[model samples]
Target: MIERLENVVTFLDKYIAWMFVLVAVILFILLYLTYQCCLKYCARNLSKRDKPRHYRSSTLQYIRFTQVVKTPPRLSTDSHYQTIPLPNY
Candidate 1:
């Protein structure tokens, strides 16, 4: 058992860097696939008009109104700046 453990340790020591790289590549692929799936799901939902009854909740029903007001901009008269003194710590 000790000999087997030593052999395994030696193998791991030699290929630990490669193992890290392999794990990173696997994680990147997993995240990319998840992102793609999320995008596809979002697109599919956005393209369809008919949604499930559960999705047709009353919370989505609301009235939205926008009012645009035209206002004149105020111009600054004085160019002089005032400086305040700070206390030393």
Candidate 2:
């Protein structure tokens, strides 16, 4: 009975180790495929371009300012003002 138990434990340990290795290999394959896909996508997009135009200026001109006339403020009559009581919190 003890020998059978030891063999079973040994078998289980080997099985568990293989399972871990299989999982690691699968994850590595998936990550590599994802990386390759992203590289291909970036290469395809970067290769085609509508090239943007850049305009260069030789000299800067002085900005013109427009003068605005000030208008006089009208005084408000006392009847237009009102006071409200604040609510207690």
Best of the candidates, TM-score: 2
- Any idea what lDDT model 2 has? 0.59
Residue by residue across 12-73, what tens digits does model 2's lDDT show? 99999999999999999999999999999888776433222221121121111001112333
Residue 31 in model 2: shift from native, Å?
0.8
After TM-score superposition, the amount by which residue 80's alpha carbon in candidate 1 deviates from its true location, in angstroms, is 48
Residue range 25-56, candidate 1, lDDT tens digits: 99999999999999999998874544434434
Runs in model 2 deviating more than 4 A are 49-89
TM-score for all models, in order of appearance: 0.41, 0.50
lDDT of each candidate versus the true structure: 0.61, 0.59
- In terms of lDDT, the poorest run of 10 residues in model 1 is 61-70
Per-candidate clashes, comma-separated? 0, 0
Off by over 4 Å in 1: 1-11, 49-89
Residue 17 C-alpha lDDT in model 2: 100
